[model samples]
Target: MRQYRHFDNVLLVVFFSHPRYDVNLDYYERTYAEYFPNMVFVGPASREDAGFNHSYDVIVDSYGSAENLTNPEFYQMAGRMAHHMLFTVMKDHPCYHGYLWAPFDTLLNVPRLQQFDQNRFWYHSPFGEYVPNSALESDQDPDLHAPPARISPDPALNLTEDWKGWGPDWCDPHVGLPACLPAFRKAPSSQHRRLASFFENGTERFLGGSSDTLYVPGIHREAFLETLALFLETECFMEIALPTTVHLVVPPSERILFVDHWWIWQPPFNATFVRMKWEEGFEVDTFHTFHWGDAAEGESWRAHPENIEDVRELLQESARRQGVRLPVATSQVTGRSPTASSLLPVDQRQA
Candidate 1:
């Protein structure tokens, strides 16, 4: 095993909505502080409003309505805006090297924070192939609104012509993907600049960019890909089209890594634990992270505190085993002092 270096990078958790059962930001602050005392969490202040601000290290803000509406282009732009913001914060700030942008509803069981190379842009899912789960009838069922599929270099479609109006002659194919687009923008406002440049550079390279190279998150933030938002817009014919479907025609040569469980209806590649299975001392190292799925049935992480504890424990244990000194627990950790009895169980105490 490789000896892990002390990570100087900051972790950023981005959430668009505050789930009903979601743990207070303070809880996350305190918990992560134990392992990554330097980590930060960024999210919207409330689910109903569109506002942006930073709390401790967590960011609270709303996705502007214009960007988050049902329109496909708006959604693609919104994702672009979020990634641009992340790049700006990480690149501009002197305190951190890289950040993690996780949806608020996710249940994390990340036992150890791996040292991801900043040279490449890494994402939980690469090609966006959403394999169907047991709940779904089949993987190719177009009617099923399954989780976003992982990006596959080789789709079942042709690669010569632009699939949905995007390719190498237009611009970098990777720029179309939401997770990979931020890496391509020159600045946080690069989207606007790129739009302007598009006028000057012409639609050839501007719209037909290639996304062949593998993007290692911290290492290559600028590599582009057709984002989920982009796909939805083009395939579903949403209100706005972002012109990111070039990847569907010309997939990357490198294999993209995806979060094991992107679609709930499909069985995960190696899922050791499912939703609400943390209390059984279930090991967290089995998977990097687990998606809680849509917010319809109140099954998200916001509704489960025990799962949060499970996530915290897994990360802490990973840190301990790695010989990293955990941060001291303080009200600053949770934004409140610990109660006597709640602190009785050392393991149960706030991170």
Candidate 2:
């Protein structure tokens, strides 16, 4: 007998900015709400923005408030940073299993989520575990870089001189030190000492000598949240900061799932184009569509007019078979094709 998890078993958190509000948000809201009833939306919203209708059951507008502690230096990555902080604030929710950081643009087909192992961490396969000198080679590939510059091979493990500007208290407003401090204190003292030691001394050893990104596979709630809280208090990219901190303490039992949703898209992506794909049936358990206000890269089949029509037909048929109308659009607003908007450009997509 196969068992699937219920909506209440997992809390889905979706984050986006005001700039991306109009772009297929209504579609995402309707589709996801029907798909996963227990979901929340978080973003930077002003008083003017608050009165508008949002699709999710709960909305956390973290703008123009002291709680909005997003780093300006990483403005391009603020949405992701906001996501990490959102987890911190909502970690204690009764969702017995765990939570997922769902990109606002992603259209997931999780027919088997009930079988998902809560302790298992989920990530894509593109970024493998950094194994010393061997893993760093990928950063040197010109095809991987848009401008062709060298990036730190292992941004997670290495702390180079370029990080001088990173000071403590970088994301304090968002993570809420006062709230997390009690949890931090509750964590074993040994964990605290080791994390402090690494932050102060271990960085010099793995200096990569250039600006590059880093990624972490997964993070455990109750266990590592305090250490994560400490790391959030410091100046570090969330992607790099998370796994780096986790590596220092978490054991092997807490696993990471390297998910490969799709292949890499060609470079020089005009910042808006992405490569989206759909076949026989939406079999992919999880998917991350790259950007909300974007289209497919010029040549990809996902963007091809014929393929888009085929996918629309498939979606209609699938909805019919399931005994439901296609997720009806509530609002009149429509934007780019959902298939293209879902495809994220390779380099610019979140790690």
Candidate 3:
């Protein structure tokens, strides 16, 4: 087993949102602090206290003075903007080698973290092969290196030179279906015809960009900004934007590793522990970032109690496998006991 040590050049960004029953501050404090303590936590003002309370190394208050309508659509856009802001912030600080947008509610499988190589870009796999063929055509076009023209002609909306070529339709079918279908259905007759006409011709223009890549922070800052700009043009979910940008810039051979088996879902009311599979080498298993209608619901395995227990056992088992002995509880020499099961490794028999 490889020993995991914190990298000072890496910046771990945690996107924390409010009105979330699933946000586990304690877990983040214990897990992230132990591994990647130098972190920047970004979240909406509604839950600013949560981040501040955790004593995070850096707490960024998203939506500080911005005033906008509070609705589902606005919320979705806000979430996307939060990610964009994080990237922009990173642009100013060039000392970091990589950046990580870790989901707030996910539990860290430490042994798995030990195996992570920061040199590669990591991202989520596609939701399934539902994108139109045309969308994929440009993926191989060498000319696509140049960012697309500005998303809008409005001077006020004009993105910086590095921020051009952002537009939409870059997600897998399953992920985009729910978002696109509703807009397609609610449109007036003219808009409906436009959407219908596009799909009838082929959704390649709409569905071709990559939405999820497991790791991406290792690219040069300029390339990262360019990739981010391309995704912004799509005005799609950042999950889709991430991989879409990577596909645009990263060579096929050097593309980031993908998290295939990891499950990211909303923890149900009954979930008592984190749910994951230790058997699978998931790059990052995320859960409960935000509960957006049906979008939040995910795989059943994410909430099963058995699987949750398995996650715990896997952590301890992995520790033992790594030749790390759990500290004996109720130590006679120091009279100290372990405080956390997920983080602190301690012998259960002597407790």
Report the Cα lDDT for candidate 2. 0.38
Q: RMSD, each candidate, Å?
A: 12.5, 12.2, 13.8
lDDT of 2 by residue, 1-351 (tens): 112224434556666544344434554544444344445555664434223443332255553233334746323334434535444435544333556665565534343233345556544322222111121235334233222111122223223333334432322333322223343344465654543443434331111111111122234565556556664554333443444444435454443343323322453221122122222222233434433234447521132223223333444544443344454322222332222322333233221
Better of 1 and 3 by TM-score: 3
lDDT of each: 0.33, 0.38, 0.39
The C-alpha stretches of model 3 lying farther than 4 A from their native spots are: 1-6, 19-23, 46-58, 61-78, 126-214, 264-314, 319-351
> Candidates ranked by TM-score, best first?
3, 2, 1
Write the residue-wise lDDT of candidate 3 on 183-224 in tens digits.
Answer: 223324442243233234422222232221234455555666
Name the lDDT of candidate 1: 0.33
What is the C-alpha lDDT profile of model 1 across 120-146, one tens digit per residue?
233333233332233224424433331
Candidate 1 local lDDT, residue 345: 32
Worst-scoring 10-residue span by lDDT in model 1: 206-215
Candidates 1 and 2 compared: the better one by TM-score is 2
